[model samples]
Target chain A: MGDLNTVVQSIINLPPAVILALGALLIPALPKRLRSPWFILLPVLALTFLWFLPVIQLSDYCIVAWNYADYSIMPYVSDNLSRLFSTAFLVVLITGGLFSWHNTDSGEKIATLFYASGAVGVVLAGDYLTLFIFWEVMAIASTWLIWGCGDVESGDVGMRYLLYHVLGGGLLLAGILVEVMNTGSIQLQSFAGLSGSDLLSNPGVLLILLGVAVNAAFPPFHTWLSDAYPKASITGAVFMSALTTKSAIYVLIRLFPGMDILVWIGLIMAIYGTIFALMSNDFRQILSYSILAQLGYMVTAIGVGSEMALNGATAHAFSHILYKSLLFMTGGALLYSVGTNRLSDLGATLKEATDQDPKFASQSRWLFGFYMIGALSISGLPLLNGFISKPMIIEAIGEAHYEIAMLILIAASIGTFLHTGLKIPYYTWFTRDSRSGSKPLKQSLNSKASFGEIPVNMNLGMGIGATLCLVFGIAPVIVYDLLPYNVIYEPFRAYPIAESLLTLSGAFFIFIWMKSRLLTPGVLRDLDTPLRATLPWIRQVFVDFPWAIFEKAEEIVLAFTRMVIKTVRNPLAWLQPYSSEEESTSTHSTEAFTPAIEIVIGLILFTSLVLGLFLIF
Target chain B: MINASNSERMNQSSFFTRLPLWIAILAAAVGLTLEFTLLRGYASHWWNHVPAFYLLYGALAAIALLGLSIWGSKVLNRQEAAGTNEKEA
Candidate 1:
């Protein structure tokens, strides 16, 4: 039994992230038929490795620790919190792969697998350094996903996305660097709620919050979500939606809970995203804004800072990933069947049609049923995952006596249904404004006529997602047990059910009452108005930046050349040309190079000062 | 002329249009009845657990958003033609 325990511990100690990452590297070389199965297999292997470890204290149970001379790093740590998120991430990886099975681009597959693995990497990281490494990996790999959506505009958008995240990464690294210098140890689990004085005293914590908040889409830093997500590939968006923001939320809940300002930031995001999403025309853009809104709930829960609220945040993250992926999968399927994502143009079912090859008739596509399940679940309808989890946070906030915050959150729930549940589906599948209503439309990704059915794998991905949503909802404890904290909150109670039903009814009423207004298909302006308005200037910064560098370098070289020419032509030019003395001091080499030395000295001092602070404080 | 497909989908999605009306009425009736039930909590603030509080709040929130959105689009939004010119620049 002792030997068996040792063996189990050794096997489980390997970080699932490393396994998935290595698996990603090997994917491009795999046989064509084997690649699809490999996608599902790798994440499953990682999950299995996470699950079967000997029960022990969190520090001892299946930990991978490395001691390098003076520095020690624990790269892999398994606890309930890590395992719960890892499980959700791996399942989404499998389903996302399934949905995009027909996309033959190996680069897309490899980048996506790496992106998913990076998310697991963050969850399993036991120290700040390990967390930073995974955080960067997720940022870079997800950028590739946006670019892989395949167009020149997507390329530029991916670059913009990369630059913003890089700024966030810089702040995070600065914080971690200062923290390690101050504390001289790398412990990063279970931070207690800090008082305002503690926060004021520490600059490191504030830097970390700013870094994480960018990814969480906290108000002013949020436009990146709306800008990039709508342009991502159908399957890629599914993966992107599940990981980046939620992982940031996980880090925040783990580290910075109970910050009073988080409540207001979250409420603003919830209402703000909801309103814009209601006004947006594209279904995917609507979903993108919905990400901001959904994240607001999780952020607010983290801010509320009770065991029940933390549990709600955890459970809600798990359920949101599943349903949001389902919603994206529905979009992917629709985009595959029809040629566009415009809600006004996208209505009509499959009709019988044979392609150029007489034997090839497209199969029957029934995505609406699965789509409705996702829509209703997101709206927090009764007997769905969002219902089971979202209410817990609201109840916690209300119980904690933030009655106004709770009211706003409930109102935002109405906005959630207004956009995601009603507007998107109502415009996409149920509208009668199609240009040629009776004829079968052609598919874009594949050159087949819209006829028989959606791809089986796509439907399977959505079905699995919808099933999990229903299961977590009906028997809510499955999610509750997996949360990092223990809390007793029941969802089947009357008050919550009453509120959820009423919110849905209210959203329904608003949608109808403003039906004509919302029926007009056009884009709403984002709060990040400057980003779009000055896009040309933003592009010119990048476009003009390299030439500016070259021009500066040219000036420096020309100055050096002129100095050399003068020295060769007239070595005594440093002497006064019209001085009373016929000759100046013969060798004043030191005085001649004073300005150059000053410039070099200034640069060196600035670099050392910045680096020295990290070393000292 | 409306196609068969359009009418069928309308029938299918009639729930979006009709269910709200029915559920709004039902929520009003049942929420009022719940005021007498043991499940209702103490009203710490003025608006706490008002009968059909969700309905009143959600409807008012929606209307407020609509009014604000109309004003924003008119005042804050640039023309689509302007967007094209910017992209070209």
Candidate 2:
């Protein structure tokens, strides 16, 4: 009885990431029937363990550590922040698992489990070393999802994705090493007190910031997201949409909250994501860009560094994960059902799907409803989750008296509505080619279409996410209670409602006015343009150039080897300087071993043999 | 109209064609009214003192963003290679 109690206690103390990771190892052995259920159950069990663990507290840290050599490695650290973020992650995992319930690919399933585990592990980690380990695990496992799509383009995109993450992981490791040496400790701590130029003095923190920035999709480094997400396996995109950047945001919230530079950086990201999203034509690509824009809000809140602001960032991240995953799931369903992501062609693609499966006719309407919930939630429409969380950051900025920053964030919100609320829904489900008198463009019909019925599980997954968005939106206290800091804030007030409605209305009107101008089907370039353009040159300098020089050197060495061999064969090939024409005409002349050459060779060999024999004697 | 399908012709005359514009106008009107009346007492920020500030600011900001994006499209949009676009996938 005591042993049983001890075992139960031990299991409760185990980190949620370890549970999922250990369960992931058993995936392949499970029968196909059991895999999906197991996947869903794992996160549920992890969440149960997370909540039931005795040490989890709101204000103080309760660490679960393993002593190794001279190090006290704390792998399970329970604070409100890690707990809240991990809860969000686990919830998304369950929903994502359900969404991909029909997927037969065990490789993708395993990768997803490991990927999710890594993300949860990062937040739970008490030390930098543990954080870096989980960070690389995330990088590698997520790359596997990209590759599992099994297309030439996805393969290429996955390689690029891996390269970026590996680079990020390297930078993080460098920072961690420097920090350990300088501080004589690997424990993670807040750099929030280091502001402005004081941050310049902490090279380790700066390196770590740069590393986390890469994963967070902070501009220039952000292209990997847009470039890869739209091309990921339909189900993979759903998980990818929720995990990577949000985990990085969690890290920022943990490590660098209140760093002043992040405010401007966040503002830039917000505008940058909005602009790029507006110009994009791919549905999933648009969502990916919006993730960047939304992440900007959280980053800004973290920069504000107030209790309400950090709480706001955490709440927004939690809500963003759900809604964004829902959007991606619906978008994935659209992509899965119609086999395309082009915004201008979505209506026609759905039209095409009706012929393949009659049920596909109504799927679009259902998907649109689900998609809008996500869209409106992200736009911070009143009564949705976005309204509950987004305004907190804006209000915090307002309270801090950075009036311009407040206004810019407000404008960014307007832009968010402009694209997500108006442009995406408008072009995807309702657009008509004016030239053709309300018909979808004829060219879109000419494209290949693989129309089918959306799986029931996909809808169920989306329904769960949509329901959570509403529940959280209507009851902000549920999210508020989980916040690390104690703060009183209200979301459903008259002023916020008016602000949201006015902004959305304004965006909606402009969208109608600029409808034609917004039909952007062309591929959009971003800061990644120079990188994409110079990729071949980079390959040439790094790969092809070195190989070419090596090849030339190899050829010269081979030619010298051949000359020595020829000399040994006849003893006259080098001694005789034949004209080029003579050498060309008489290919076999040297092979006949002339008597004079053979005699000289024999005499040299005899002399060498005699000298060797004398020396041995 | 000679080569058009029956559904295409119906789409041209459908209520859906005009519904969005009406909705946008209605929403704008309601938003302005709410900002001016019901929510006026809730104004704590300086910008809130301006008449229909959120409505006007939202509109102007959207227009500026649209202008900037249109310019951006010209500089940034590339012709995607055939069979390489996400639509085909």
Candidate 3:
């Protein structure tokens, strides 16, 4: 029928993000048994819509377009860049949904769906307002993923995480407003001119870049990622791992590609992450820091601003989402089964678990096997996903002739393998040495921690991620074809393979030599140390002081009202002096009116008389 | 050096333990050979022409990162547990 066709056409015109968001709202209403299935089905449906949609233009394919004032806002864009990023977000949603299948809390599940919708929306948005709205949605929804852990620390960590994001969202809004006022347009494509020093010279672009940098986990602004993700609920960490930073990278690729300042910022950020990851004792904390390191490579490629580099950044983001989520899933599985995330605690528990039942050790080995696949993939080992993408960025930098930047990135590659691939596994599963002298197993054994079997769903999620890593790595064309640019580079060639093997081998050898020294325990203070230390004082001065002043002013008004009531109700009481005892007990009471109150009343009466005379005249 | 796990100690001579070392050695040899022979023409960049450059570069870079990290860890190491010092006070 004609009416049915209209309905179908309308649904088809809806953005994929909006469909997922509407599905997210319906989650709690669904039966408990259907929640996980519904969660997985939505992204799959969105992915289908994403690919099957008709393309009007390959570069800026817009759908669901609407006008705001004089500006035409495209809420859904299906360019190659957006498509590549959206595909990753949607795929991770399915895998993350599967990982959290056993989670009883519908709030966290709903938050993740909404969070993915925000990320997808941001990537697909063709204008700044749409981008900013989804950017904040991602921030707010992701914060729930942290707080939904329902732990004592989760609340505090989530609050800090929210504050950081609110600040970022504010900066982004300010930039968008300034840019619209200056240029009279909100099109994101207009930022292509924002390259080199011109980016810094423009206040709007700089503010926008600063906002995106906060989400990208760029150095001093990056502590939130390390601070929050480890503290998020077990399954929530998996979703948080995939969405937040990569979406920022998507924004950067779309808006600020080729900004020269990013080159240095990204390089420092890469080393900063590696250094902190090396110092960390918590398993998930190390992974969080390594996310920063991995993001650095993509950021550096974006700074290069060539077709190959942008493609490399895009490809790396797609691959990073898969492998990193797998790593987090394994980390989450460890926390779920073992009731601890500390590396020192994990080694002892696994050791004790092995002593209790040998089979437990083998099962733990299977978890480790899944973990190593991700590790090797991230380390850019030959025949893995990292090899296919990371080399493109480094090769692009080499082509750009920024030899120093290239060398530092390669060194960072060595550090990545050292900390993540070698040190995390060695210290977590194999080491007998207790870097921290505390007997963590005592607490874990008595609590919910167990040597029992890991849930089947966890393995299924990890298996899906592992399969994708292999599929994409073996067939580089799959990822290459998804890229925004033509593929001219070869990852399988002799030079890159040799380079990856040599660097990874050298990293492996050094890790063997220095694994003991690297098995550090206890808190590794970062730049956030000073911030956390001063946050209380900062809050008191910035937040509490003004509030105190407002309260004092409110008290004065209440006192004056009481005096006026007494004057009107009993004229004799207004003339009578207060006793000293009454005055001391209640300073703001009607009985305690002083000369200042009388002078104010006299001035008011005089003003009323003058106003009355003027009106009569 | 990483101490062997109890299971690995029981089979100290297992090929898996030594297999990584062998692979590293062989990879270095093969990488060096490829740089000199079949991949010689692939050296479009100046750094690629340096003999066994990536192998040396990777080794030195690893050492430098480890050395710096050791010193950095010593400086930044906190005896207090995480989140304890920053409790909601």
Candidate 4:
């Protein structure tokens, strides 16, 4: 043990995020064939490095804290809490790379590596600055991943995704600045309830939690995930399912454990994700909502904040990354096979998979098998990972005396089943009608692109994920021993397993009986409506004001739009229609564009808006 | 339960055509039986081991959420075309 500690301490501790990010940078410049192999290799190397790291505790030097003037920024930590999550992050990255190996281009793979690294970086961060830097990297990298999907729709969704994250990043930066100013310490620890950087009294800490909530996909702040994730490329969505939100859950566990408000927030999220998941039209969209519901369990566990609850939260995150990524990979396979991602398109692909020669049968048969592993595991069925981890959280929270919260989570699992476990598979793989909102196989599948057999790499990616779900379910200790908390909770005990099984049983009867009512694909809207549709309508206020006021109002709106434009170029970019033809025409015109006068007006509006927002928020 | 040809019957048994729901049903029955007879299940909180606690609580909570989600879907659910580009508006 002493020698091991010495080895861990002596080695140069580079943050795994940096290694992956630098590796990603080199990939785009590499030859095409070299790029595909690097996608799998980089994450494998990072995981190996992360696996070799020993458990770190209370030691400043070994934790990789760097000093910049008065600020102590620790970019890497090797505590069990971070190690547990980092292990999962690398696992999904490897799987996602394999899933994408044959399908995606170098740019998409590069963004995925960076996104994974950002998540790994945030998990290991020991200070707020370190956390914030990686948090911003995640914001940009994930947006790039979405943008690389190569569709105008994805580009539009990518911009919305970027805007939400940038706002989240802005909030986090504001919180960090205030925290440093008021407390004079940069350590990444939770504020007290009402004193010593108390979130209750301290607006800064509250802001920081809100910032994390956006990434965690807490209800009302969660529309971006469902809106953008489904639009990303096959592999992009797979990489996405593993990171961002899970990293947010890690930060929440670290920073806001035992805060009672999280219990309520979590319940809302659990119910919210469960319900909304059932309403989506696409496979990935439902899974995206399922991700929200699942994160609710983790968030709720963090709120319970006992050692057992934290352990359950972390363990659940570790398991969820694999299953969810597999779910997305299956969705990607279906999407690649059938062209469109809508649930109605499954019949077109299923016919191409089955009902064909024996050769094609092996592919869809295994594809269905892999998809079910993810679905059953997510549903918390017996002898699967969800059974192992989901009930552990409920038992822990119940032990912590949050009975109502515990019961709500138990109930929410049914919702998880309704969508992810039941609806997604039934509709995506089982529904065999190429009618009404669905196109037939002949129309959808051309000779060039086929869904005959999922590529070996995609199958391997999903197969590994499914295998892990089964492995961890059969042997809970593989996860338990690695938990930050000492293990006492056992998932295989009779009563908890009985309770989970019966609950799934009872809810399933309702599913079979109420199948038609529940199966319809409907879009679920949230608080973001006011920001998207209502905001532009309200922009007409500038049109009706006094001429003098109108000019100034346009400047103010322009100033704010410009700020938003700096971070997000679309959505608002459409407000200014600048084509090359227009630019050329304007160049030939006598009208001169003035910069100084506009700058003065922008400055005044910018200052006032900031003052107003500061006073209001 | 009438007999079909061997090859005809063999064709009906593919694992691909159906599996998850059956496994769910199988697990549920097994769990229900174990809880009823041999296995004495434990609960972290009070009243968890009472007769049919899992069935009742889980059912109630699921129903409540389902009801709430249905109501929410009325307000929250949008048309398929709702995702059209915002720039047009």
lDDT of 4 by residue, A293-369 (tens): 99999988888888888898998998899889989988888777556566656644565445543444556667778
lDDT of 1 by residue, A1-617 (tens): 99998677666666789888989898889887778788888988888777864244336533777776665777887767778888999989888878877666778888888898889998888788889999999999999988886677788779878888998899888888777788886757455567445765788887788898888889888888888887787778999999999889888887877777787888999988887787776678888889899899999888888888888888889989989998888877766654456564554322112222222122222467677788888888878998988998898898788888988888788888888887776666555454322223332224444333457788788888888888887898888888888778889877777677766766677767776566434455676677767877866787788779999999999999998885577544434333223225534544434344555678899999999999999
Worst 10 residues of 3 chain A by lDDT: A440-449
Candidate 1 global lDDT: 0.75
C-alpha positional error of residue B32 in candidate 4 after TM-score superposition, expressed in Å: 2.6
Q: What is the lDDT of residue A241 in candidate 2?
A: 89
DockQ of each: 0.21, 0.41, 0.34, 0.27
* lDDT tens digits by residue: candidate 2, A105-169: 78888999999999999999999888999999999999988888786888899999999999899
DockQ comparison, 2 vs 3, better candidate: 2
Tens digits of lDDT, candidate 3, A323-420: 99999999988877766777776776666666655556667877888899999999998888988999999999888888899999999989999888
Indicate the residue-level lDDT of A415 in model 1: 81
True contacts kept of each: 0.27, 0.48, 0.44, 0.41
lDDT of each: 0.75, 0.83, 0.83, 0.77
Query: Sorted on DockQ, highest at the top, how do the candidates line up?
Result: 2, 3, 4, 1
Which residue pairs in model 4 clash with each other? A495-B41, A523-B78
